[model samples]
Target chain A: DAGVTQSPTHLIKTRGQQVTLRCSPKSGHDTVSWYQQALGQGPQFIFQYYEEEERQRGNFPDRFSGHQFPNYSSELNVNALLLGDSALYLCASSSPFESGYTFGSGTRLTVV
Target chain B: GESVGLHLPTLSVQEGDNSIINCAYSNSASDYFIWYKQESGKGPQFIIDIRSNMDKRQGQRVTVLLNKTVKHLSLQIAATQPGDSAVYFCAENPSYAGGTSYGKLTFGQGTILTVHP
Candidate 1:
């Protein structure tokens, strides 16, 4: 009955460094997707993972990558972070049968 | 180049008043549309959704109306309250794109709604 859960609600990172954010999807869900939201803007789709393989991706650069474990959990990794990388990273999970997706509280990444 | 967009950047209304947020989408092939509300420091929450076949769908206190002719969609909140204040976004899915991108959503810039008590 647990909703999507993300780790390290907030974090601070310096430029050129890499960071990894984790997410535990809602029970009975198998699909995981990541999104990035900048200040005063809506979230932009990053990529989606289904069955441990990346199925769909947005217009993000190659520096942004993600992985889905067998248990349906996911991790988003951003390499060579820039100040512009500072934003709220949200994780959402959905099932193939459902029309709506559920989102986690999100991890706030601050690039210094 | 197809994208979703909102008509208003911000909206402020007094409590107990009805509120309407509008959005326009360029992808006519998008058959599924959804509305999401995001609070400060939180992820977007699903509010309601409508498909191309249907013109309207109603939720608890929210309603979504889809006009495929003009490629416009609307979310109406009845008796807006302070808790209703948040940034609203409209998302679309191009189902005809193929199976691999079936659930992929393209989101709008969002409309900020402020309900003053």
Candidate 2:
């Protein structure tokens, strides 16, 4: 089965600009979660979506948002990007709590 | 918030040797745990997982051990190969009421493993 897939393997944006990343969850999975991984750091949770609604979110500000479609694909949107926002954005898919989540290769955002 | 952490920042071992990476988690309420390995420029790959009720689980050459008494978890790689070089992270899933906690993984700061020839 195809694993989680993300679009725009790499991207660059200027400060205060906005960017959107996309992800397709693994086949047969319904839940999608987004994470931000800085260099040499573990990924930090951004938000999670299930049943087409956001169920949980992390400490990120309102600038970061996400959406999940009926097909289980997800999109992450960040407005007014800062240089600190430049990091690897990962998308993970899973079924339910206590189940393992599968990660995507991630989209590397470079805010200049 | 839950805190999952590694005991070492980096570990280097010769090929053919066994490698043991240790982790500590602050959430005793966490019911599930996982180990993931991520190569440079790549996303984390699932290795093995152990539930809070179990002490150990084995997968091929990798093993995960959990000690709830001490809030410790470990991953052991047998006959470590050069391809094993990567960052390893331990993640936790804390329990919650109802269906609120839907398999959200809280990852620890990973440990870098360097297997040399």
Residue A111 lDDT, candidate 1, scale 0-100? 96
Q: lDDT tens string, model 2, B20-95?
A: 9999999899988889999988999989877887999999999999999999999999999999999999999885
How big an interface RMSD has model 1? 2.6
Model 2's alpha-carbon lDDT is 0.91
Give the backbone clash total of model 1. 0
Any residue pairs clashing in model 1, and if so which? none
Interface RMSD of 2: 3.0
User: Which numbered prediction scores highest in DockQ against the true structure?
Assistant: 2
Per residue, candidate 2 scores C-alpha lDDT tens digits across A1-112 of 9999999999999999999999999888898999999998999999999999998898999999999999989999999999999999999988644357889999999999
lDDT of 1 by residue, B64-104 (tens): 99999999999999999999999999999886232232557
Q: Chain B of model 1: TM-score?
A: 0.93
lDDT of 1: 0.91
Q: What TM-score does chain B get in every candidate?
A: 0.93, 0.93
**TM-scores for every predicted model:** 0.95, 0.95
Model 2: residues >4 Å from true position, as ranges?
A: A96-98, B96-103
Residue B45 miss distance in model 2 (angstroms): 0.4
Clash totals for all candidate models: 0, 1
